[model samples]
Target: MTKDEFIQELEVLIRARYGVILINTLEEERALDLLTDLARKLNKRLLTWSCTRGLVMDGNTAVHPDTVDLMTAIAKAEQLAEEPSLFVWLDLQSHLNSSPVYIRRFKELAQEIRERMPSNSIIVGPLMEIPTELQKEVTIIDMPYPDLNELKMIISQFAQQYRDRNDLQIDCSESALDALGRASIGLSKTEIENCLAKSLVQHKRITGEDIDFILEEKKQNIRKSGILEYVDTEKLETADIGGLDNLKKWLEIRKKAYTPEAEQFGIGWPKGVLLVGVPGCGKSLSAKCVAASWKMPLLRLDLGRVFGMYVGSSEANIRLALSMSEAVSPSILWIDEIEKALSGLASSNQSDGGTTSRVFGTILTWMQEKKSPVFVFATANNIGSLPPELLRKGRFDEIFFVDLPNEQERAEIFRIHIKRIGRNPENFDIAKMVKLSGEASLGDGVRLTGSEIEACVNQALLEAFFVRNSEGHPEGDVTSADIERAIVQSVPLSRVRKEDIGYMRTWATDNAVRASLAPESALSSAPESPAMAEVTVGRNIDF
Candidate 1:
């Protein structure tokens, strides 16, 4: 549920359970204001709980009381015959875990107050962990990140303030407002307000560029979580990826669902996509490229980072990471090499004494129940190693098996790599290169990625420049020969893990994973079952 809904529900529950209520939040300074408002609404006496400057404010102004100590404050509160009084304990929960005497006294005071006057004690802290003894009496409410409406209201307030000061007129269009709202998602009110103040001061005017700045700030927040890495991909688009046409189409269709227009039309956004197949076949590349293609921010969730040393810290970290991702909706969450990260969970107790299992459970629960538009792009190299719970239908929208690139895809890959290095594909014979790297020989040589190919081209260009200077001849452009030599020298993952690749191909085809390639293309390149050539009298078979 949203933050507002959660708060409203808490308010209702508090009213139902106890005649008097205390509402406090983790927001340090804002907690006082919130509690004051609650006190006014409930017509209750406001009492503060603090050790340093105990009971500083009575209602509005500071009225230092005689009883400032914790025991003294509790005694004063209990002695009062007020029908309803809210005792707001701020930043006191942190001390409860370590101080047993304080916890016992607080519980006894709560029990006694509930019987006499309609009084309730609320504990507020950055992190909440209720002991088993007080869990029955306490009601925990999650204060979620701010929503778009709240963010928009805050931005408009800032804009109006700016216009008032400088006599600057700014008319925010729907698209501009949307950009700002989306950029501010996953940020607290204070954070967004701070960003707006900083942006206005820096740019002298809030424009679309400010929206990008806000997104960068949000990325920094995600990075601080330590579980998710905020990656800035350098213009890597779907076109940059040569293979995975089916997967590309799937992502393209869902990209539109993130727009305001789609929301108006009541179109539900796609949850996620699972890429499972052999390694080095653009699975991970597709994950990164999809984020770029959608024009959304990319957050790489390293599952390994979620496991913490503390008992419950791992689960808490997972929740925080997922919460942050949801706050930044319409974003791509790439979990690269997922199988390896989760493999330990299969024998969790034997491996890490059930910590891995608990972490895995937390992740699985989030994936299933999450309502955010954070598109999960999970890539698994070994499907067998992945837990069966992850392979279930509802976990991801569709499971796609990305096989080795076909001849057409291979040619596109070559072109993409060549152009990436500032060399036109027209400068080289791409068709001949494809033929030379066909099925049998290509398995080893042509398995080079766009990145590896670019590196080879760079090396070849250096070699060509040196040769021209030494021989006193014109510098020649890098030819297919250079790429061929690089291919021969470099070993591809396909060559090293041939058996593994073959096994994956057979598994994908047998299990009916939606093939990322065309049917004819898949049939032609049967890496699992190679076709044997028959000899004829007049005809010859070529390898």
Candidate 2:
């Protein structure tokens, strides 16, 4: 929520005489500033306290320093029968729940303050720790991070501060300021200040380039959260991924879904797609491509990390992660290997005390009701582990089954990997490798995944890299012979998990959209494709 909206709400609550308000926030200094302003507007005295400061007046002038103890502060607050007033306890939650006596005293003080003259007490801290006894008396308010307008205000102020400086310049345009505001959504005021200063120092001017520095700052937030990973999408391109033509086409159609023109055309933001099928078949890579292709930040949600040990902690962590994603709208949330996170869903009630069920339910509900531009790209290899509710209609906009690459896709994959490593795809005879392998009869090469093909290419390159010619110099180019040997040495997942792959194909045939549109000629001639053979998997693809 914006600072103004928060102040309006606080005004309403204070007017209605809410006994105590607990604000959960990381921005303690910003929250205190808002409270002080609110106090002045409402004609109330503002008193601030800390374990060390001991109940100071507005946190500057001390009042009875002997009352440094929390219990004494609570007692003094209860006795304060002055005009309408607000007492803010800064970081009190750090030690508020450690002792039963402190919790009881807090409850008593809250009840007493409610009966006294117009006065309110607020506990401001990052952690939310309200004892059951005081849950009824204390109201919790989650202080949202700075919104776009506030961020813009911060930027304007920052630029204004350097208006007199002769060495530095502010080269920000109006549009650039808007973009910076959008990029700085999830950052705190202090973080924005520090980042703006860093940007000026690094480039000697604040311009569009600072957005990259701001993104780097956000990476620190992701690292600190430990649940969501900041995926670097700068190097990823839709062209880097081979095949999944259907999926690529779908993504391209909606590439402008978040644009203003689309909004004017009355198109709602695209929800997202769920990719489920054989492992190493480009499901996860597509997630990265979606973000890079559409120009959005990529956040990888590790559900396993969201499950916390404390009671109610798991739910809170998921809430925080979702909120963080929403804050950075027009972004992509990539949940890789989602099925593994929900592995215990079948017996969640008996196992983990229903924590898994709760977390899954939270995600399901969010996916259905969320209006944010945060598109979710979830990939799963173990389809059976996924609950029916997740597969039901409307949960995800579409579910695409990423089957193994066909012969044509395998060739494309080989070309992409080979080209990426500075080698021309035409340098090697990919077709000869396909025909000579001789194991091309099983399901028309339905087993060749893009990853395995890349592996084959890599193996061939390694052979060429180390092998010495008769002249003793390193071989300059990879050959069909080298590729054939690599393909022979490797075994694709299709043959090893043949039964599982067949089951998946059967399920996907009726239940999901196909990600590939393999050419009939390639499928017919190769039959099972070179991937069926043990001899030529080609270049290695690393995620």
Lowest summed lDDT across 10 adjacent residues in model 2 is found at 534-543
Per-residue CA lDDT of candidate 1, range 364-474, in tens? 888888877888889988877988888888888877777666566767888888887788888887766655445456544235544455566677667777777888878
Q: Which stretches of candidate 2 lie over 4 Å from their true place?
A: 434-446, 469-476, 519-543
Query: 452, model 1: CA deviation in Å?
Result: 4.6
Those runs of model 1 whose alpha carbons end farther than 4 Å from true positions after fitting are: 18-26, 29-32, 58-72, 80-83, 167-178, 207-209, 264-266, 442-455, 465-476, 512-515, 519-543
lDDT of each: 0.69, 0.79
Estimate the TM-score of every prediction. 0.88, 0.92
lDDT by residue for model 2 (185-258), tens: 88899998899999788877777668987888888887788889989888889998888777788788878787
Winning candidate number (TM-score)? 2
| TM-score: model 2 vs. ground truth | 0.92
Query: Best-fitting candidate, measured by lDDT?
Result: 2
